[model samples]
Target: MLLILLFFVAMWAGAQNALAGGGSFLTLPTLMLTGMDARAANVTSCVALFPAQIATGWTGRDLSRGAAGLSLRTLFIISIVGGAVGAVILLLTPPAFFARLVPWLVLFATAVFAYGSFLRKPGEANAHLSPRGAMASQFLISVYGGYFGGGIGFLMVAALTMAGQNVRIAAATKNVLAAVMNASAVAIFLFSPDLHLAQALVTSLGATIGGVVGARLLHHIPDKWLRIVVIIIGALLTLGLFLRAP
Candidate 1:
């Protein structure tokens, strides 16, 4: 029964990630409910959902091109390196400390995404970040993606849009970059003692299907609605994290 529930949860998470980026908020709690510790749950979630990210990214590959002044190759390298750093930090972090930080991190990501999605001026939609700013933002977002990964998708969308990509392109590009960033973290987590193979496998299958579905929906959804949905999910996840925090 728990496995069945996990499959459904992973489906939703994969679609949510493809749509906007708070999928971790769902997957993390579901993993914990299945008796995994927080750290283990985080690692397992990253590992299991990774393939879905790749599928989603692949479906939108034409739109997942470079952003700002940085080529996709450069961004991929940055994501790989940053993700490794974040995975190492996660492995070293004490559970209690990570718990204390979770709410604040979600809140911060939510605010940034909100501002970028809704509050920014209309003229700013086409604004481009400096080369340094784009690289720095992507690096930090990649690190966060490798670590907890709850709101990383939204963060990437926000950063990419600010760096001059339109919303659709930003969303597609985010999926690929996110997949690249999480790949390193997944490699590190594969050896984790706490990983639950059965759970990960079930989740992976469901997420893979959902990812394909979600990627297909990308072109159908209007740009305005996409941004609105992403912002709403981020805000709700922020509230949910705060309420669930100890």
Candidate 2:
């Protein structure tokens, strides 16, 4: 029954990834509810969501673009390197410490999402970021994506809007960049002691299905409402994590 529930949630998360990002906001907590430690759950979530992110990114590949002077190739390389560095940092952190830190991370992610979704004014569809700022922002977000990635989609949206991309293009670019960011982390986590293969596989199956279906439904779904729903979830999740017995 739990696994069944998890599979369905994974599907929702995958769909959310396709539509607005923040999939890990679902998977990380769901995985934790299964009794895995935070570090293990985080690792497993990263692996499980990788395929769905790939699918989502590929489906929207045509719309993706970089900042004014920064090419996609440059962003790609930055994501890879930054993600790897963050993954390495995660690898070295003590499990207990990470468990303690999960709540704070989730809280921060939730705040970022809220800002992007509600407070930030709509940007011009064609506004481009200054090249240097875009590159630096991409790297930092990549590092965060590799680390926790709960609200990465919105974070990318915020950054991309500054680079002259609209929400749609930002979503597409983030999907691709997200996949790239996780690629290096996945390589590192593939052999780690913390990964839980069974859970990861289950999520992978559900997320893949969701990614495909969600891509098709992207045009039909109300993105703002979905984001609002996700924000509510993130807030609740953040509170729950904080109140949870350490």
Best by TM-score: 2
Off by over 4 Å in 1: 215-246
Going through the candidates in the order shown, the clash numbers are: 0, 4
lDDT, model 1, position 44: 86
Q: Compared with the true structure, what per-residue lDDT tens digits does model 1 show for residues 1-246?
A: 999999998988777666655666677778878987777888888899888877767777888867788898999899999999999999999877776677777677667666765686767666678889999999998888888776676678878888988888987898889889989999999987867899999889888777767768868877577656656766676687678766
lDDT of 2 by residue, 1-246 (tens): 767878999999988877776778899888988889999999999999998777767878999987657888999999999999888888898988998899999899988888887787664435556889898989999998888877777788888887877677887898899889999999999999899898999999988888778888989999998888888888888899889838
Native-to-model Cα distance after best TM-score fit, residue 82 in candidate 1, in Å: 0.7
**Cα-based lDDT at residue 174, candidate 2:** 84
Q: Output the worst ten-in-a-row residue range by lDDT, candidate 2.
A: 120-129
- TM-score for predicted model 2 compared with the true structure: 0.92
Give TM-scores for every candidate, taking all chains together and pairing residue i with residue i.
Answer: 0.84, 0.92
State, as a TM-score between 0 and 1, how close model 1 is to the true structure. 0.84
